[model samples]
Target chain A: MITSPKVETKNLNLYYTENQVLHDVNITIAEKKVTALIGPSGCGKSTLLRCFNRLNELIVGTRIEGEILLDGKNIYQNGMDVVDIRRRVGLIFQKPNPFPKSIYDNIAFGLKIGGMKNKSRISEIAEKSLIDTGLWEEVKDRLHTSALDLSGGQQQRLCIARALAIEPEVILMDEPTSALDPAATFKIEELVTQLKNSYTIIIVTHNMQQAGRVSDFTGFLYLGKLIEFGNTNILFTRPKEKLTENYISGRFG
Target chain B: MNIRNITDKFFHYFFLVSGVSAIGILFAIFVMLAMNGLQTFTDVSISQFFLSTRWNPSAFGEPSYGILSLVVSSIMVTLGAMVIAVPLGIGTAAYLSEIAPPFLRETLKPVVEILAGIPSVVVGFFGIVFLGPLIADVFNLTSGLNALNGSILLAIMALPTIVSVSEDAIRSVPKDFKEASYALGVNRWLTLVKITLPAASSGIVAAVMLGIGRAIGETMTVLMATGNALQMPGSFFDSVRTMTANIAIELGEVPFGTTHYFGLFAVGLVLFFMSLAVNLTAEHFTKKYRRYRT
Candidate 1:
């Protein structure tokens, strides 16, 4: 099936102070589909992911010189509402970073911040978000307990639920399972595949098999450049770039 | 054991005694206070000692020794100081941790520490000369020295503790939490107020409790500034005395082996327990709310 590009970067170059971190690069991410970015450490995968929501601005002296468009609108244009951009495009961190609040509050925080005041509607969305992330039954009874009490996998899922509760059109995950064990990683990988039917998912991962298993479209980045991009199955099996082949075969990261 | 082990053993025993001696000194203080203070209850009925509002020990007639007024003065002054300090201190802390640029935060931090390090007597002097005159001039009171003066001085004294500790608490909240809030599309101000502040609430509460402890135990400033009136305090403008101020003022001139002398010790005993209770409550909050701090 063909999918329209939800987000696309045009000759994106990012600099941290004097050091150029992301070279002139361009890539298209599909809507309502799981797009995985795989590369070794320091390859600018996470940096590119952060560009989608302008989270890179949090770091001082970081500069972006190119346009990152969401639904064909330049997000980096002057006077663009960053908070609104981030609301439309949410993100999940590598380690599960839930608030110290209870499970219910963790999910309700975004809705309340977005000015949703109807109590019953907030609860309904909170319950639905939990169900979407597959954590409802396990956490339903303990909704008021601290989110920190959940296990690592459960905490990561709660982060996803929290993002979903805000109803963002795009969801970005930065190595969302890097801190989890194998079983937990499997659950998250499965959840990522299942979540693509509704939200445009962009996942940055270092694991080759995870990228192959979960993503419908795969982009291999190397040395701050996109080395290859294609269907995940075709990219895994067929050779288009020597660097992609070399990195994929476990010769070196 | 080798020579190294022998040296380690020696240091271990030495440190053990060193640590134990701190508690020993505390026990000695409690024992001394109890020895001197228990004698007062024999003549000063518990009701008369703690209940009555009058506190005249040297009356030509039957001396009335009620500490209720002093207690109220201390609490009211300290609470008023807290009213002034908590918002300002926490605001400064939040600015340092979340908003202020690096140079501003660095410059302000040492200023707060210096504020704390200034001698309480020096603060008392300022209270009497500057703050007292300002309060009287602004409010049109007869005398500047009052609970308001005491509170202003105590608030200055308490600001350093509150700002220092709450700043630490706010700073220690993981950057990840702030980032997470930003990811949810909340503005920076809302994130700091709703998420960052609440996440650091445990440490902030502990900081506020410790400020209360500091304000309650402070003696010199209140003694020199609060006019040391003996009657029940009616308003913030009314001259009054705290238990610490009372003990400090009378303990020096009281004749030896007198009930009045022992009465001062009783006041000291009560002040010590109040400070102890405030500190313990601070510690309790720190421990109880630290579970989610990870």
Candidate 2:
């Protein structure tokens, strides 16, 4: 038996004014699985990740030509609310962009925006999300402190918890652990592995070892094209495309 | 020493002379005002100057210079202008720095700043020609010039400073703060209120103080539009006189050594102290904000 794709992108083209960024791309992300998009810098991996939730719409002069379907509904359809889409398909950025607010408020921000008004309920959800992200033990005592005071790794985890507090079905992470130390990177990878059991996860990363360890499926992107994608074991060990072989073998970035 | 050493000594002397000259000018002005006005403080009760309403310096064939009415009128007009300018200026700044597109912002920002370059007399003329009559007709008054007219003119004059300084401060906020708010799906207005404005609070306060300083020190606009009545402002439409206006109007008429002459000096001293206090407060907040950003 086979399952339907949770998110499907068909002929997705994005341009920054006269400069084309992502060219004629097509991909599908399986539901409730960890899928990683791997590429070098400026390979359009982050841009493609932003399409799932329409985060690119915030930039001026950014135009997109494509169909991105979330659970079979076109997200770009007329009258579709971008806020609602973002709430359901949350995104964590490359850098740890925590709000200059309390640690608890950082997680509660999304919930309050989504119309979750009950204070007790917000606290409950924030605590649960922090625990799920494995940051509860370290920050449980200072929940009222500013989020910016946290270490880089802890801030990234706090961002993850913020996204999780919204109860998003799919979480998009763009180089989530790249800014962290080795030990924090290991901890995030463990958290990602555990999170995949409940939520569909798509991550963009340049670290091949990280992708290999955390992702069950891998898609190789090179120069704005999805060159090849398959099970992580086969794609890393025996890639069919010469470009993928060259990229993974470390001949060139 | 060589010729070069001699030239360097001359240059150091030039710097020292200019720096000391600037301070000396300020101290000279203070001492002059104090010496000229010392008799008023000794002979006249200070409370009388602060409490009495009549400003007829020539009344009863004697100098009857009471500035309580003029001071109160100045405060009223300045307060009214601040109430109008601060919100509009800060809102326009927030719009320019955070919301307006690059094209619109580029065009509107300079247009807003151009208000600062226009001469204050020209602004007063405009108020006298336009706003004064409009207000006079609405209130069925005999004269067009009044506190309302002066306040409207001063508010327009103060707007450019408030908006430009505030826009700079809001622009100085880190881009990451905005990104964090947007990522949470909070709307633009809420983010400005909750995050951006709070982070830039000290800067905004400084901008307001600068605007107040500009409004209080304004002379020509108040002289022309406020009717120079030297009476307490009973309402927005009532004619009034400010301390700056009083000094400008009376300085040439009073004899050089009479009580009336020293009364003008006293008013100047009051104006000087008010501006100094405002500037010092702004400086303190600016330093506090700089430490926070660092």
Candidate 3:
């Protein structure tokens, strides 16, 4: 299938102090499609996902040498607004990290901090996002209660609703299901499939079956190198690299 | 049925005895203070002791025994100390916990602990020699010793507690919360103000209440620096005497069984209750903070 790239990284290399974490690599994320990065631990898949929005730049000893482009413009270029880049590209973490606040405030915090002040409009956006994530019915009655009170699945969905409220062009998920149970993981995976119709999503996962089930494109990484990249269906059944096949076939992580 | 069971029971009773003894000692102290302090009311009327502003127990003609002024003075100095300490302490804590490198934090934390260990009398002397004169010069007052001077000294004494406790609270706010806020396009400053600080607010409040308790209970510094004036303080700059200072000043010289000595014990009782109230607030907030954590 042919598609335009929403985000691209070229000759990207990242180092933490003296240790290299991601080698020179290039990849394109298709517009409005879910791309899954699958690898074992320490493979730099999460690092790559963070790079799309420059989240890695905050770490103390990290250094990136290469161009990451959002909409064909180098995000690494001089005079880029990091806050603007982050606003456009939202991220969710492995753990469900709702602020110790109400469910309504969880969704409204992003908008309010971004300078949205109109009360009715903020409520409208909050309700719309919650409905979009299929959490409105479950949480609507208790929007004023602490978000930390939600179950793992509901909390993860609340986080998704939180991201949606901000209206980002792309969303990044860093092992978002790793901390959740199987049922919660299924809910998140299904949400990912549904989300791709509107926003470009880049997900990092260690579970091969999860990548196959949810993603249109899959990139298999091994030991800081992108060993295989292509359609998810082909990558799962017909991987060209031996390491990718070995990892996917359960021989070794 | 076995020696193991006997050992377990022995230790359990031992710890139970230890715990019960602590409460027993506290209760005994309260009873003793109440018994001695209540005796003063027999000689001096309760309304005069509590409501009057004059406190000259050694007046030549008619000795007065009011404590309202002393209470007001203590409150003034404590409030003034808190005004200076809370912001500075919380800011230093935030910097240490959120921004300071590991090496600096490690070095500075021990330094703060040492600051707490400095003898209060020595700190009080420093207040007399340095801070009191500086304040008098700055504010163009006749005397160097004042409530502001005592407040400054007490704020220095309270910094270690406030800084360490607030730092622990801020640091305990999960890193995940900060990361989530940052991912939503908020910067570190905004995240700290909005999410991190609010999340840690109960703990920070507990720290502040503990600091207030420390300032109110402090005797030597206020005794030396606050000029020990008997009048009710009108502002932070006024010379004043705290209840702790009053008790310390009069107790050593007063006759053991006289109304003056018993009156001092009554003041001690009031001071105890004041600190108890502050400490109970701190404990309550600490419990509330723990609830948020889990």
Which candidate has the highest lDDT of all?
Answer: 1
Model 3 off-target regions past 4 Å? B1-24, B60-62
Over A7-110, each residue of candidate 3 has an lDDT whose tens digit, in order, gives 99899999999999999878889999999999999999999999988889889999999898899999999999888898899999888999999999999999
- State in Å the error of residue B185, model 3: 0.7
> lDDT per residue, candidate 2, B1-294, as tens digits?
999999999999999999999999989989998888767776568878878887887787655667888888888889899999999999999999999989998999999999799999999899889888888899899888998888888899999999998898888888777766666667778889887988888888999999999999999999999898867778988899999998898898878887888888888888888899999988887886777676
In candidate 2, how many Å is residue B254 off? 2.3
Q: Tell me the tens digit of each residue's lDDT in model 2 across A1-253.
A: 1175889898999999998899899888988899999988899999999889887888888999989999999999999987788778888888898887899988887788778899999999999999999899999999999998999999999999998998889999999988999998898899999999999999999999999999988999988889998889899999999999999999888
* Model 2 backbone overlap count: 0
Give every collision pair in model 2.
Answer: none
Error of 1 at B23 (Å): 2.4
**Where does model 3 sit among the CAPRI classes?**
medium
Global Cα lDDT for candidate 3: 0.92
Each prediction's RMSD over C-alphas, in Å, is 1.6, 2.7, 2.3
Candidate 2 chain B weakest lDDT stretch, 10 residues = B178-187
Q: lDDT of candidate 1 vs native? A: 0.93
| Cα lDDT for residue A104, candidate 1 | 96
Please say which candidate is ahead in TM-score: 1 or 3: 1
Number of the predicted model whose TM-score against the real structure is largest: 1
Model 1 per-residue lDDT at A237: 91
TM-score of each: 0.97, 0.91, 0.95
